[model samples]
Target: MPEVFTNELNLFSGQLYMKSMNEYLSVRRFLGLRSADQKDSEPELSGSSTNVMDTETPNLIKFLRVLTMKIRRNCESIDKTHLGRILDHRTLDDSDFANGMDMDM
Candidate 1:
């Protein structure tokens, strides 16, 4: 039983980790950064050759703002979905429970 629980915990953790990684990749792609799998192969730029900060600061700021807004929207959507689920479970009738329709809770 303990081993089963440990396996389930590990599976859940792995799923969460994958979800987080996917989100990170999505944000990185949205911001025009290299994805994780491409990082190792991506070439490093020389700081002496170009002044990126001088030319790209505005673009970077815009990208960051867009990313922030997207994250906020996603959070709001998730909150609404969670709250709806909670309200639905709270409002389940006795007949719904007896019919096993409330098993989703």
Candidate 2:
């Protein structure tokens, strides 16, 4: 309904729909589709469907150098109550960037 009524539809949902359609024939169009090639463009997607987040988690968890520094600074300055909303686990005083997750890395 949101897709039909508004332009502010979730971009990620649209992306996932398109990705699924491209990866699986069941999700693809049965008519009015024109392709110049017999082979599928996404040969990599042939195997069992994988969790999208599993593939993307590594990239999502890492940020650019400057952004990482800003995050660290914010973490250090923020109080425990406020910071707890953003973090899964919290320390009493200084910000814990998760076990073994060094800011330098």
Candidate 3:
């Protein structure tokens, strides 16, 4: 995991942590580097993620719904293009980037 996300994880709620993780994974997938990762690559964030996603607003990160169910198992297994938000501002569209569309940062 990158320091930008991991550095503040202790202060982050489970939901934010999960979003950061998912976003990191999504970037790796976007770059086609998932297959190149080694077996043990949990760099900074320690412990299991089993209880990290405990959030009151479960829909904040909006995990891709499958059959009306958001997956809780193997959460790292899902690499989705998420539109991360900012305060009163828009974020780059991951879907557009994934589809080879230009983004203006």
- Candidate 2 lDDT over 1-97, as tens digits, reads 4222221222212211122223223211111111234344433223322332334533432322123235544434222222222221221223332
Which candidate, 2 or 3, has the higher lDDT?
A: 3
Candidate 1: where are CA atoms >4 Å away? Answer: 1-19, 36-58, 61-105
Q: State which candidate has the highest TM-score.
A: 1
What lDDT, from 0 to 1, does candidate 1 have? 0.31
In terms of TM-score, which candidate is stronger, 2 or 3?
2
Off by over 4 Å in 2: 1-52, 64-105
State residue 85's C-alpha deviation in candidate 1, in Å: 33
Of 1 and 2, the candidate ranking higher by TM-score: 1
lDDT of 3 by residue, 1-105 (tens): 754355234223222222344454433333222222334353322332322333422442243223112343234332332323221123333353355433322
Ranking by TM-score: 1, 2, 3
Q: Which residue pairs overlap in candidate 3's backbone?
A: none
- Residue 78's lDDT in candidate 1: 21
